[model samples]
Target: MRAVVFAYHNVGVRCIQVLLARGVDIALVVTHQDNPAETIWFDSVAALCAEHGIAVTTPEDPASAELDQQVRAIAPDFIFSFYYRHMLPVGLLAHARVGAFNMHGSLLPKYRGRVPINWAVLHGEQVTGATLHEMLAKPDAGAIIAQTSVPILPDDTAFQVFGKVVVAAEQTLWNVLPEMLAGRIPRLPNDLSKGSYFGGRKAEDGRIDWQQPAQAIYNLHRAVAPPYPGAFTVLGATTYVIGAARMARRTFADLPAGLAVVDNSIFGVGNDGQAIAIRTLTANGNTVTPEQLQQALIDNPH
Candidate 1:
């Protein structure tokens, strides 16, 4: 089988590996150049393609006439997108002789838009998974081909959950590629009404709202922790990024909804009188220990 792949990140790398392992002739790989402003943490699809001697292009726009012509010239039997940032145009998708499919970070039709893993964690979803589906004009509103569920533990960070989703994407593609190559495509309904769609998140969205419930605040912290931007709150003139936090066993009823030091441990007192123990906190890229934070709170008890 012949294919043109549009991919990026670890999921892209692993899914491409699956295609290569299954003996698919990858005619071209379309990927993005790493944004210099963003942290480049994931495996590169371009690097993997180079190692395998596959043709690669880093196009600014996948829907351009130039790219459309290029894919049409290849006349690939299939087109697969794994974690590619851009949505392929309908014209571009039509270039594939068989079909074009995409791998999404969450099961359809839930978490249908951007940053599914993070959104799942933020919403305290116990389970979120990878979904392979046909590419349509609307983003992630396609018919499901395959899905593999994975657990989302209570304290699982977005980065950790993303690891599981990447593995799930690999397994889903690996298990279904042979059948797809044999022209036995699966088309399960992706009911849009039954699902939710979220817009892309910004770093500012990680601003912690102490007025929320303790679990909600903790979920926000987990959702954007570490590799994703850490959830943050302002204390006087300084901004403190919450690197890690968990619900406290006890409430601090007397404390206002904000940061507090209770028995030497830094806690976030929520509006519901519940507390969240701040495990790792930072300010200006420097770790701020409980003692330091306590002193700061004491110095500025506004």
Candidate 2:
């Protein structure tokens, strides 16, 4: 069956490749333009479309009528969205003869909004998954077609969990494609009351609060660690990007909360009296040791 794909990034690229390999006719590809300033870890959807000689469009407003007309002209039997940034309008969703579906990074009914991976990590969820669901006007508030779980290890960062999500997404799609093409895919309605929604995060949101528990601070560190924005804490005038930390086995409540040199290692005291040993850190945009960081703070007191 012919399909119109609204996709982007690594997951999008993989989904498109799978469709093409299965002999599905890709009528058109709709994706986002890559930002040169942003850190990109995946193949661009536009680039992938170009390599296959397929028509591709990068429209900022997926809900616009201009995009609606474009997809309507294609008259696709199915519209598939994989990691597509914007919410598809009802107009566009209705244009497809069969149905429109999207692959969400988190299990449906939870972590439904933007940056699902980061949210899942921040909340200390042990198991998050990919959900294939019927596309709706609201963001990720869709009926589930199928889902596959991915484990979130205590040590896993957002980027690491993202890798697992990519695999789960692909596997979920592969398992449900045949039913989708046959218009027999099951739809399980979600209880909106039971689900939680999180908005998009910003670089400023990565600021760490030392008053939190060591595990919570560690969660914040991994949630926003590189590929997203690294979690940070200000020491003097310099903002230190915290990449990795561990919950110290011993409590150091006598020490004040926040950055401090303890036994030649950098540790952040938390509200729980436990310490988070800073394992990886950056200061002045350069990787620095605990001693070096403390020296920088000593040299530049604001």
Candidate 3:
């Protein structure tokens, strides 16, 4: 198969590597144009492709005349969109005879927009899946070719889940390639009635609200937490940031929820009698102990 890989980030590199391993002859790589200090994992993939004498091109835009002309020249049989930053234009989507596909991190059409894994985790979903689908005009609203579920462990961060999903993605694509090439791939229409959309997250979205019930606020904790942005709260005026967290149960009924300290952990109590322990936190760029955390809260209480 003469394939075109549209990729960005670490997952994008894996997609290239996996396709290469499976003996799929890549026609060329279509990636986001690298910018100053922009560390998207395109370098290694570009280098690998170069070493193997496969073409690599960074399209200035998905619909650019130059890019369109280049792709037409390569005449790829299959197009795989993996973590590509730009939206694929309909003109490009229709280029490949075997069709273009995207690797989505959520079970669509439930979470149909960007960063679906984070949404799934924030909503406390125990199971989140990767969906491989046709690249339609709308994001993640295409017909499904295959999906494989990934576990959301209590200690799991977005980083961990993303890693798991990327690995799952490679396996799913390689397995589906043959059927897809032979024109035997089945596509199930996405139920638009059940789709939900989320926009790009902001810095303010990470601000933690202490007044909320611990469990209710658990999503806020992980939603903007790092390798993302990490949830934060303004203690008086100094913004205190929180990283890893878990919903913990307090056998003692008297303990107050969302409280700053108990047993060297900053905890918040929930209505249903559970305490959320926020471990691994940074305050004003300093790692602090539970006692220090209490002191910070007091000194900066807003």
TM-score of 2: 0.95
Best by lDDT: 1
Model 3 agreement with the true structure over 1-302: per-residue lDDT tens digits? 88888887666778788888878888878776566654342235666667788778886778898887777777888888988878888887777878899988887787878888888877877877778998888888878998878898876766678878887787778788778877798889888788788877677877766556676677767666676768776666566777778877653357544446777677755554566777777777787678887887677543
How many residue pairs clash (N, CA or C atoms closer than 3 angstroms) in each of the candidate models, in the order given? 0, 0, 8
**Model 2: colliding residue pairs:** none
lDDT of 2 by residue, 1-302 (tens): 99999999889988888888777899999998888888887888888888999999888888878888888888999999999988888888998898899999998899889999999999999999999898888888878999999999998999999999988998998888987888787999876788889999989999989889888988998899887778898867778998677777788878777777778888877888888788888877787787787787578642
Clashes by residue pair, model 1: none
Residue range 1-302, candidate 1, lDDT tens digits: 89999999999999999999999999999999999999988898988999999999998998888999999999999999999999999998998999999999998999999999989999999999999999999999989999999999988999999999999999999999889999999899999999999989999999988889989999999999998879999878999999878889998888889998877788998899998899889999999988899889888885
Ranking of all candidate structures by their lDDT, best first: 1, 2, 3
lDDT score for residue 160 of model 1: 96
Taking all chains together, the TM-score of candidate 1 against the true structure is 0.98
Off by over 4 Å in 3: 33-44, 47-51, 251-259, 269-273
What is the Cα-based lDDT of residue 208 in candidate 3?
Answer: 60
Q: For each candidate, what TM-score against the reference?
A: 0.98, 0.95, 0.88
Ten consecutive residues with minimal summed lDDT in candidate 2? 293-302
Between prediction 2 and prediction 3, which has the larger lDDT? 2
